[model samples]
Target: MNKDIRNLSDRIEAVFPKMVQLRREFHQAPELSFHEEKTPARVAEILQALGLKVRTKVGGRGVVAVLEGGKPGRTVALRADMDALPIQDEKVCDYRSKVPGVMHACGHDGHTAALLGVAEILAGMREDIAGRFVLLFQHAEELVPGGAQEMIADNALDGVDAIYGVHLWTPFPYGVVGLRAGTLMAAADSFRIEVIGKGGHGGLPHKTTDAIVIASHLIVNLQSIISRQVDPLQSGVISVGHINGGQAFNVIAERCTIEGTVRSFDQEVRQFIKQQMERVIEQTCQMYGAQFELKYGWGYPPVVNDSSETTRMAAMARRIVGDDNVWEIPPLMTGEDFSYYLQKVPGCFAMVGAGNEEKGFIYPHHHPHFDFDERVMKTAAELLIRSGLGYLSADSPEVTVGNLYR
Candidate 1:
């Protein structure tokens, strides 16, 4: 590794314990979605102490901190999601959620702490940098369509040249970071199908067209859209998450509801799946003599990384953690709101390893018992710093808007 990068790693290691403390504090006081009032206030106070210009409530509890460098160059952004899930805490740690029904089951506590750690380090090394550093503390990540879109609408990415974000993944082992050049995460879109039919006695089978029967047919046909309509190589998922029909067995309900999500990495595939879903729902309802209504909800776009930015950041990560610590993992079906920022500006989102077997902290995201090893806090922070600095220092633009659209 390079000397400067090694020195930065050592510096982050020295401050690792403080980052753990910050993470624990956040873990104990978890907040949900747009209601992250206390969380963003605490973050703003910390960033202000670090000598950065902090702005609060950018887009409903979203915080953006600007740290100007000694010299003028491009602007770069580093982001962390600050919202917690609605699950009750099941872990017996000292920092268990004090909120009755809210928990940091997705490791967002670690994400916030890691970004704060970067702010501290960059504040101290302001002279070494050549451009502005924008630290984004985003809210409502778990919500569909995400807080990122709101943040962008508020001109959070106006002057930003590039951005970087990370998720603390417990599936990978400690000391290993996973990344991909493009389409690191899939686009998550939701659909709801409501079928209306005549209500009649269950004994009179021929008297009414059953909505429950029509909903069942719609579910099966929706599954076939991915298998028969979409290309097998281009991945997509259509799962029926909820089905509600008649309340009692004796009565055929007048209405039935079917709701599910669609996930895909490619935009074309996403559109195809949506079109096929509507076609199947409409045709099946017609065959059963029922009225059908479909509501397709759009979520975050796919997180497609800029190759140049990812290559540069990966090299920096290998320097901070080691060549053996970095892995080129395949794209995931999970969605991230950070994809919105990447859609506006060129950026990359990487994963930080926070799994530790010795402490039994290996649960996947959103699980009730999910927790992460606090030791990885420093590593995640250092990677963000390195990626931001490296991208700002690069001669050419990491990614252009035209390239990203393509």
Candidate 2:
């Protein structure tokens, strides 16, 4: 089966042009979170054209396509996120987004295109393959309460076996691939803090409680949660991204607001940080004689990959990109809703490098100017193909996620 899977490189090569074309098309017309309509329609159209059993409007806007092989074995699933970001495209290229202020800033267009390429290649090899293949084209990965959970609730994973997925990462150079046995990404959560104080003329410092000054102090003090509260060996980050306060230079503001995100790998650490943050908020407000409110919302859990599946997929990746390029990288602070899928079944989430310095494709993801060397899409597609088939060819142990940190 490995030999047979290797032979699909020519097939992957043959489909590369179409993959680029599809990516560019999706890039030109991008869609955001829940507003996705035509993208999933086109996805269903493409999958239906390939003669697979397709389900649409799944869990809201997700699309699922099932391809059954001639020989029976187990069912394996491959997932790709289909939504774009709210960022406006800044690059001056032919395929730059047509939709104003909506762009595929994070390379989800490339993800969907690569998975479609895999479907095309595998559909042609159906007679020679065993087991079934489930292709999940999910929506709303950028926003929390993501499509993964909704899709799962819609019975997208009502099957017999394992799953696999990939992300085209720009930090690593083209041809390099990365994954870890434990947590690959962090659990993302967000919060909003409001400080209420007495207002007075700025010239009279003693007359006002000064909410703006309190918010500024709160921002600096919150870092202590990660530094002093959380264990030094463990990882945690509290970044305040947004803040609002006074209206005029001469006036002392009565209210101020602060908003930001929290990222961590451990559930207890996540909760502990929140508790410590609340403690800091209460103490700081009391000292300033200010009334305060804290609103915290939990997002996706951390993405933990199965040890056995990740090991097998890493061994498989060495064949395509060589042993040196296969990476067991440190866990990322980024969040992924794919964690929801891994919770229900055993699977592996892999990352393939799309950055290339020579071609000037070095922009990080989610930036307005973000873009990657499109050539790596083929490598990503091949990895998905090989991983999905490899999982089904042999009896794999049930997924067991190891420690949060290596």
Candidate 3:
């Protein structure tokens, strides 16, 4: 490693303990989407302590901190989500969530801590920083019409040349950093359907319009939209995860509700599936003489990485983790609100491996038992700072757009 890089590595190691403590504090007091009252305040206080100009409650309980470097150049934004899931923490650990039915099962705690660590590192080297750094601690990433949209509405991307985000992913083994040039994650959309019918005795099926039966048919036909309606070359998913209906075994259900998620990488395919699903529900209900209501909510879009930005970020990753540990993998089915940031400006969202089966950190995100190796937070922080600095120090426009690195 270069002498400067080695020195930065040492600095990051020295702050690793602080990062762990921050992550633990967040884990113990996990907050849910849009209801993150305390999380944003805590983030604002920390950023203020770093001597950065902080903006509180920019958009839906988010905090934005701006650090102006000594030199003049473009502006780069680094983001971290600070909300938790509704799942109750099942792991018996010291830092487990104290709030019932709420936990940071998605590793947002680690992401927040890592971004704080990056802030510490970059703030210390303000003289060497050529451009300004914008630190965004976002909220409600797990919910639809994500916090990113609100933040952008409040001018979060104004005057920003580029943006970046990181996720502590458990699917990959520890020490691996995943990156890709094109779409890295799928678009997530959800749907809810209500089949309404007349109730009657279960024994006399001919006298009643069975809502449960209609819902069952609708569920099965929804899958056909993905497999039969969509082109085979394209990928799509229509999964019905929830079903609620009848109260008694001898009574026919008057209404049944079904809820599920839709995921796709292509916009055309995503729209096609939505239309097909509505068609199936309408036609199926008509066939059974039942009334139906359907609601489709569009969530996060697919996170598409700019080729130039991804290539430059990958080069920085190789420098930190060696060539073998850096991977350009295929797109995943998971959705992220970071796609919103990418929609406005060029950015790359990298997945940092935090999974370690030996240490019981193998569970997937949103799982009650999900946990991650804290050491990866150091790698995450270092990578963010390295990418930010690399983009700033280079003088050429191509370098800023992610062609050549300093």
Candidate 4:
């Protein structure tokens, strides 16, 4: 680490207590997606205290704070998701969520607190830095289609040069930061299959075509798309999360509905999976003498990192966290709404390790017992601050918008 970054790291360590307090306060009163009314107000107050120009309701409870530096240069963005999931809290901590059926199971509270901490640190060093820093507290990350697209619609990234986002992942060990040059996260799409067949007495199997049997066959065949169709090197997942059919066991159901999600890193593979899925459902239902309807709802796109931006940010992260703490992990099959922002601007979304076995904070995200190690909050904050500063100081390059849909 260089002298400048070492000093910033020390400053971040000094603010550890404040970061913990902020995260605890947010954890106690969690809010759901697109309904973060009080969350934006609280985050705005913190940014206001740091003397940054704040804009609220950019995209329905999203807050953007622009902090101008002492010198003139390009603008950079640092983003943190502000919404929590609708999961019941099971942790037995004093700071456990007070809101029922809503909790920060995905560590969004820690993300918000880390960004606020970065805002505070950057505000103090404004005189020594160049260009502007935009701190984005986004809402509705867990919601399909994401709040990031809404923020772009509101022109949040209009003048931004580069953007950076981070997620606190439990899969990585504590004190380590993970990054990848491309395809950091997968695209998520949902599908529903409805099988229609004749209904009759359960005892008379020959009298009616069993929709339940047809649905079962379709579900099993759907798994072959990943193993047999897609290349082994390409990552894809087809998971049937829910199934609904007849209520009574004695009666043959007229219709059976199956719902699941499809995930993939490559766009071509994602498209191929969807196409093969339709074929599988149609052929399987026909074989069972049943009619089928397939509905595929588009979700977030794959998060592809810009090579130059990711490489530069990784170097800065190594400087802040040291070489031993920096890691280049393989891309995850998980999906992110931040992919929307990367589509509009050249950016990178990396992961910060928040798991610590000693503190019993090793649960995966979205789990009821999931909790983040508050000590890692400062690390995330410093990484955001340093990355923003570095990007702003670096040369401003032009970004080309290719055929994103292809």
- What is the TM-score of each predicted model, taking all chains together? 0.90, 0.95, 0.96, 0.92
Report residue 228 deviation for candidate 1 (angstroms).
1.2
Pairs with backbone N, CA or C atoms under 3 Å apart (clashes), candidate 2: none
* lDDT (tens digit, per residue) of candidate 2 on 201-278: 999979999999999899999999999989999999999989998899999999999999999999999999999999
Report RMSD (Å) for each prediction in the order shown.
3.9, 2.9, 2.4, 4.4
Write the number of the candidate with greater lDDT, choosing between 2 and 3. 2
Deviation from native of the Cα of residue 405 in model 3, angstroms: 15
- Runs in model 1 with CA error above 4 Å? 1-5, 200-208, 249-251, 395-406
Model 4 residue 274 distance off true place after TM-score fit, in angstroms: 0.7
Pairwise lDDT winner, candidates 1 and 2? 2
Question: Which parts of model 3 have CA positions greater than 4 angstroms off?
Answer: 1-4, 395-406
- Of the candidates numbered 3 and 4, which has the greater lDDT value? 3
Number of clashes found in candidate 2: 0
How many clashing residue pairs appear in each of the predictions shown? 0, 0, 0, 0
**Candidate 3 lDDT over residue span 83-193, tens digit each:** 999999999899999999999999999999999988887788787677899998999999887798999999888888988788999998889899898899999999899
Q: Report lDDT per candidate.
A: 0.86, 0.91, 0.89, 0.86
Native RMSD of candidate 1 (Å): 3.9
Q: lDDT at 185 for candidate 1?
A: 95
Better of 1 and 2 by TM-score: 2
